[model samples]
Target: MGEAARYDVVQISDFRLPGGTTSSIAEEVRAQSEAGLSTALMHAAGSVTGYPIPWSTHIRRILDLPGVHVATPRDRLHATVLVIRHPTVIWSTPSTFDHVTADHVVIVVNHAAIDGAGTRHYDVEATDRRVRSLFGLDPIWAPIGPVVRGTVLQQTTEVPLRDEDWVNIFQMPEGAAERETFIGKKPVIGRHSRPQPGKWPDTKEDILAAYPNSPGYDVQILGGAKIARRKIGWIPDRWTVIPFGGEEPFDFLRRIDFWVYMHHPDLREAFGRAAMEALAAGCVAILPPYMKALFGDAALYAEPHEVLALVDEHWSSPEAFLAQSRRAQEFARSFSPQMHLRRLQELGVAVPETGATRQDEPAVAGTDAQAGASAGPQPTFVLNLDPQDLGLARELTRGLSATGSPVVMGLVADGAEKDPLGPDEIRLPGPPAFHLVEETGAGTWRRYITQRLRRLLADVGARRVVTVGTTIPEPVMEAFDGQAVEHHWVRPDDGSPLDVQLAVRMNAVSAIAADAAPETLAVTILKESTL
Candidate 1:
């Protein structure tokens, strides 16, 4: 907001990524705007999982809306209501919200819950504790659905979580309202999620029992079948497989008669957005037993082995299927766009009588500080993190991030002299905030310096590299040279300014391999892979 405009609602979220949380937040902003509320939005710098949150088209459109302005860090903005979409931002970068007024109603919404805490997958209990501990603010804890709410309280950890039921803000897609019952001999059943193991059943048998590979059934899968390939060792030849983003979710949901979803035991789903959307689109959802608390009467819940029985029960009677489909749609509609407005109104927030107008088009994502910065490739800086050189590494990394160049700092073990005794050791001891990546696999000293470094650099899409503190070893340089990438070194003691010195060569680089976040998700994805 140019002149420090006050907002009725301010939402802070991972608008940096495309998925359930961002999509819901975008819709939330739209709903607020439509209800005559002035809304502002901000994106968290750190995501829960250190995943790549790209600047995609969908993200751009939401930020470009008429009433939805970026809540710039520079502005001392006030809000009647302040929303933190997930615990990720507030817990990681609490200072981002410092500009907003403290008098507003603060709501922290938890979208996902991990049972065990770690660096990547955040702990639910730990986050709840941290939010209460860090800010004197006793924020209303709003979990996305019953799953999240239940998951939080079920935890043995004692955190006074003022848990409130806040189902996801969702509705049927543009043309998904008029769906008829299936009457064919062969039925099509499917599931759409980010093809991860945690999103599927624990065992192949459990998976196959629910999502049958039998000849009589036609199975359609969106969000990739890589999990299927990894779990089953081969995707069933009978199934139709499409990667995530390959097709629209509603289109895939429409093609299927049933939405069958059963995840691993450890996965506290938090909320099933895809299934909710399917229900909105009039697909009969066959969910697990626990989901009954959230979806109630809308979706049939049974163990994986019992899913087909439920599917068959309705299949035998088209009228019954149609009736259940109607119930599903009816239930999903209860969480309509207006529900968001209703929730805010309950808290005594003033909402406008007239609706805000919507315009079509998208603008780039950024705050006031990033106003002039273009969204192109990110810049890679390899700081030599040897014990003696960490001071320079920290200074160099700090400056690179200031340039808004999507910095990727490498924390390599080969260069460090301290910890090599442990065969399977991983050292990520950090200079906080800056992400220092390194090659992960264990290897010999020779292989560590050459192949490992080359692989790590390639993953980050570093075609032109700048080494700070210590120059890359000759062997590593030679390996990169063969890959058609430029590796340049600068002495750490050089008095040159970081941003100014690199600007010219950085502009001149071929830009052939533009930097993007490394999708080093194969191993993790496989680890979570269930059928």
Candidate 2:
């Protein structure tokens, strides 16, 4: 592997490695920049809070390199194994998927130069599937594992055709029922309950004080020290307090009366994995209202604070609880593992044979920004406003002009305003390179947005459509044609208010890229220079 006079090549790095694993990736990239080599690094999206969100913040920081592009390790490993046959290959990013193949190969570079770990490990099943696709397999392909396990489990059992009288509820041993047996199902709280401040009390004294026990009903506290500490003085003599160990959480769920629990306020809680297990095990569950996003109507939602109140209303009525429990069982049965596979197949992701295969040649398309003619008489951006967005709209146009970009601005109306539009209304720090026009009309809102856009694009030959916010609406995405509009999902950098600078930037570059032939960006504004 010597230097080449002309070639397009990539280098690889694993950012998730231990400090000493592959530290060289960064230095290798810096060296390549010095040597005039094209390079990119691979990083996974950060994992979710409880789930270990893939492509974590760490990966994001690493890939924010000035000139480097980002790729996924899952894709890279596949390319290395199938196409390069080497220990490493520059993992291809989503943007680069169609460009590379097994036949046309290049030299592999490691992140060791930058002290990068070789390749980070992930779940074998997930990695294998990603690798298969990188090797030119159809994206719809998958490996057999839990997906299959779920199917096998579903096949061996039979849920009662109709709702059963007894419903069991299972969940994390964190919180217990505010009011058990609100409906027909008895409350079978988790066995591994942990005591957390505010949510759980050190003793059930508060709960008992809140509600004196009636007949046929008892409260049990589950989990380890967390549960024991919380239920210290709370548990009644009749109810059994069990310490859950190993993966027998579900086994305990099987012995439960009903599932009752609440979720965190973030609304990111899992939809009762234990509840699902209980439903399979023939238990009814009473869910918190927030769970509708995941469980739908399968579980009943009691207000988080109204547990005892719920027991008084729903639990006290055994007939009502039984009916609700039946619904839960029916709903759980609908999500059998075969149903998952069937759904995937329906989505065109599981076709046994797809016509998608790797091409011998690279893609040639309009994907990159064309080294264009010099910036024209600064861009004159026209901020077209509807009646609702006139004020902020004006501010946006003014902001752009203030940034030294030429901008013309206006409002859309059903009819033209008789009063002449003034420059004070249109001009900000910078002047419009051309005349700013405001027009109003009916039955032409789409035409108005488009015409204003085209006018601005043409006047100064603008290269981008930068909007002040996402509230610009769905119609805009459709009007620009789905192929061209790109949303800039901007998250705040300084921990500003969640709503603070949410804007959209329609990248003419990406529009051109999508429209490009094969992999080559076919159309770009050719920047011509003055003599």
Candidate 3:
């Protein structure tokens, strides 16, 4: 037979394994590996030195999945560089896209859509633009279903049922066996999620009060120490509070007759993985009405106050509860790992039997050049320098100028009438072009600067612009108006001074000028400094 086809598929994310709630990203990686793909997981959270003293069992399960190569870079910047260098397809979460540049096809799994509350709202459209600006390509959006489905499939297969003696021959947890053996006697009600104040409903206390203090019913609040602590005094006589981890959460899920989720209605659920898990375990869920699109007929919708009444209605009628529970299980089955893999295939992610190109191959050069040529003249590097960043700005200008790229050095005056740069501060090996702006309040200055920068970029016929500073002012970004521009922040490493940061920025710019593809837009360099 011919040599096995070589290809690389990698998943990059902030959290590698399950922590409080199971990471759907990790589950997707596991699913890919099971489908005979050579997969690697680059943990963007960086390195873990020693074995975690108290690790979650769910995390351990993920670590043990077959054929998964895990890597932890020294920092996120290094991880981005590594991701760019290898792989035919790069899969990432929206939050993990900082400083990451993907020359290859990128598939973004959007787990959360709406961010911020009330007037400070940001939706998927803003996220899409940010990703496009960073990577220079619109990413294909994938749902979180496959990962959730995979979890349900694994749990259903791994956990033996009470009716199946042959399956129970394998050693199992006592709680798992107990869960399978115990049918509905007294109504068991619970909710599982990462404990965070924003996730709780405003009517949480009122919802809890609806559950009677009777012996016939049981209540469990799973996940998060803060939840346990806050509800300690308020917990009813038959209620138990369990922190997230081990087999207990899963056991509790198995025992739950009604899964009550009281997340604020204004907040988007982003696929609701925890709720899906509960549904898969045959727990009839009572969630907010806005989630109808996400859950379809799989869940029962109720407002916070209506939750207790809904639970009572279901508890009083076993047939009504069982019917909804069966619908939930059926809906959960649709999200299986196989379906996820199929979706990835549909989106042009290739599954090769053999490894592909070496990591050092020039991935971005040709594309960058073509994109630059089509846009306008050769690119210009602009540094919006504050007083402290002047030295670094000067160094970057010299570096980019050496590569035959035009450079503009701009000063951010601190609302002073005179120029921020004095004769002593103006020292440079070669004279470089410069611009000056007087900084004012956020509203006025942002508009003025953006307009000035836009004119400057247009006048220079700049095909691509790289902005270097402490931070790229939001106005500068808005000025680009979704044009091709990159942001490079001058940040020193721990214990390093301005000179060290200058060196790092110079090196990163040189690399981009040398290797960046024409299609490249924005890139942020250097790890964030603490001090």
Please tell me which predicted candidate would have the highest TM-score against the true structure: 1
Candidate 2 root-mean-square deviation in Å: 23.9
**Model 1 stretches with alpha carbons more than 4 Å out:** 1-4, 56-58, 94-96, 112-136, 155-164, 355-531
The candidate, 1 or 2, that scores higher on lDDT is 1
Model 2 lDDT tens row, 283-401: 45555564565566666666545555655565566677666656666666654333322332333322223233211111112211111113534443333434443444455555554
lDDT (Cα) of model 3: 0.47
Q: For residues 1-531, write the lDDT of model 3, one tens digit per residue.
A: 111111245555444234422255556556665665544444443232123332233333454344343332211211111222101112233234443333343434333332324322223344445446656765444333333222223323332111211000011223332122225677777888766765666454644643445676787778743643365445465667676653455567887888888765455654676777777778888888867767889999887668777888887887888888888877777666665555556444554334432221111211232233334325554544455545555565556555555444444433222232321121111111123233212343344445555644554455445444534345655666655544444442233334444434333332232123222212222211110
Q: lDDT of each structure?
A: 0.59, 0.35, 0.47
Ranking by TM-score: 1, 3, 2
Q: What is the lDDT of residue 44 in candidate 1?
A: 64
Question: What lDDT score goes with residue 2 in model 2?
Answer: 11
Arrange candidates by lDDT, descending: 1, 3, 2
Give the per-residue lDDT digits (tens) of candidate 1, residues 1-531.
212335677777665555777777777877765665667665666545466635333555554344455444434556667777777666676354444553444545555554423123446666666655543455677777766766555553455544467777785678866566583567888888986777777778887888788998888888887876777778888888898989988877878898888777666666778778889889889987877888889988989899889888888888899999999998877888877787788766776666443311111122221222224544443435454554454454455455444445554332223322121111222222123233311122233344445654544455545454333344444455556554444444444334433334333231111122122111221223231
User: What TM-score would you give candidate 2 relative to the actual structure?
Assistant: 0.31
lDDT: worst 10-residue window of model 3: 162-171
Rate residue 283 of model 3 by lDDT: 85
Off by over 4 Å in 2: 1-216, 225-239, 244-247, 263-267, 312-316, 346-531
Kindly indicate the candidate among 2 and 3 with the higher TM-score.
3
